[model samples]
Target: MFSRAIAFIAAIGIVLTVNKPVISQNHSEHHSVPSPSETSAERESSRLTESHVNEGLTKLHQKNYSGAIESFGKAVEIQPSHYLAFTYRADIHRLLKNYQAAIDDYTKAIEFNPAHSYLRNSRGVSYAALGDYQNAIEDYTQAISIYPEEGAGYRHRGAAYYQLGENEKAMADLNSAISRNQKDAEAYTIRGEIYTNLKNPDLAIADYQQAAKLFLTQSNREGYTKAINLAKSLQQQSIVPDSK
Candidate 1:
């Protein structure tokens, strides 16, 4: 059960940050003003792009994943530099288990918005899903470098390290993640597994207890149940005599 829970978390626990659309304003004060015709054309393009984006979002909310991808693709066609459209398409691709396609789209998004840490993190998740932990680590590292204050990057990188059998590195990264966000139930859960692997059942149980509490607070019944059960199982094992 514990192993299955770990796999479940690994498969679905990757966080994707959605950015709201920002209204574009004229920046003539800082840069040379465009010709009236150019400005008008730009406005038309922006309007079309926004229309497609809205349509895509509506389709996404309806669970019409393929329709949403089509709409987002149109937005990209209308505005090749529309990173958000690429991101939306990539998210759908990832949901469909098309990891390589998701990675490609995410790479395009990152190329247009290099400073967006969440984009890198999302790309890393796709890479990890494809079992390319090395590439995943690189993307996660870039995300951490872009926004070291965010715990998601550290948490993800820690999980990748854990998969690579680098428990010490995983522990360090998970510690960093929990330090930044004590309410991070996922981090606690992963850390608990690390402790269990290291033969520290006491610490593992403590972490699981904390994780269970956090998960319950977050209304994640599945996570809470898994954590609490793991803690109880460990407790029972600890009380039993060694077979030797």
Candidate 2:
């Protein structure tokens, strides 16, 4: 349930970036032609790896976090350098509430291919889970630098800032996120919190109202209740004085 709450606040917690595979330096340039026996072994290994990866993904889709993790673990063992496998396994770990293991897998993925924006974002989120706002911001910043057009990186970084008590920075990033995607209810909620912290009750109420409206339109009763309660609480606190 808490995982769902965090999922609502952030868009899947990590971005997946496509990156090239890393072959070991031991791969010889003057390699001899593989024998039929060697080819058979390689094919078997590849088949096993594919089977495990597919099983892992299927389990994940079914919300079987533990099963997914186990399958993914087998895939990683078959091919230790599989960057995508590590990234995927990390996602499963997050779903399972194993934040540290998620971070470790993300790190391995990064080592295999450092240029992946999605992996950076995933690692940043793991760091955020451990209350390492500085590291999380760094990862988010790198992700944004790699793909500025994607709103997810900025949104994640804003969350990191919010966690760090840097409300101004958080607002700046959240505003960018909303500008990129106006229908982002999560952005509105975060911006609302920033406004509330700034003592701008009117603006906070307005944002919360927007969020509530969106939630209602989407038939999201829980989200609507959250936003509505926030707005009501702000009003009760007398965010605005009587003009009279």
Candidate 3:
């Protein structure tokens, strides 16, 4: 069963669910198997776990999030300590808008693999969705500490900081993210929002325009909509009544 589970998880791509400002986390290259010296029972258990995980992945890809959760539950039942199962299950819960469930699953996954930066970053997103900015910041910080060069963690942390009214920190993080990933449309959009809040209409408009262009290149309707709205708002704000 364990062996089957391992195979299953590996057979299907792991689906990740990250909220706004993070897009998604993909760790397709992280799959690995235990040493060959492991007992046959262990291998079987791994196989079972993999099989269920694959089933869950299939459901997730089909957008049947509830069914995916059930499949992940089965995988977890077969191997309680299976970190990826917990992470994938958490992802499904997020997709279902079950924020608490997602947090719980992410917690379990974190306990099993504390060094998994992607899981930490994803969990931070779950916390952010719940309006727990402090927790979200902590998780993003931990992920940054683990993987300093990762732009996603910093961008997420920046978003959390912005929510917490820490404009300076947010700007710094957004700048860092933009430095790391020049083509990051989300980063530009987020930075534009921060600029708007700072009352810097010129900078905000520039950033929004860049974001809209990037979104157009990527065919992201949502980003384009946000950019258009920001641009319109900036334009209206610029046309102020003259004092006689």
The candidate scoring highest on lDDT is 1
Root-mean-square deviation of Cα positions for candidate 1 versus the true structure, in angstroms: 7.5
Best of the two (1, 3) by lDDT: 1
TM-score of 1: 0.85
Give the range of the ten consecutive residues with the poorest summed lDDT in model 3. Answer: 16-25
Q: What TM-score fits each model?
A: 0.85, 0.78, 0.83
Off by over 4 Å in 2: 1-38, 218-220, 239-244
Candidate 3, residue 17: how far the Cα is off, in Å: 9.9
Residue 146, candidate 1: C-alpha displacement in angstroms:
0.6
Tens-digit lDDT track of model 2 for 1-244 = 2233223213433323212112211212212244567777776776677678667766665667678779979988997887766877787677567889999998999999788677788788888889999999999999888877767678889988998899889999988888877767767888898899898999999999999998888677988999999999999889567789
Residue-level error in angstroms, candidate 3, position 132:
0.4
- Using TM-score as the measure, the top candidate is 1
How does residue 11 of candidate 1 score in lDDT? 41
- Taken over the whole model, the C-alpha lDDT of each candidate is 0.81, 0.75, 0.78
lDDT measured at residue 26 in model 1 versus the true structure, 0 to 100: 22
Per-residue alpha-carbon lDDT of model 3 for 4-77, expressed as tens digits? 33333334433231222111323232334677798989878877777787787677666677788898899899
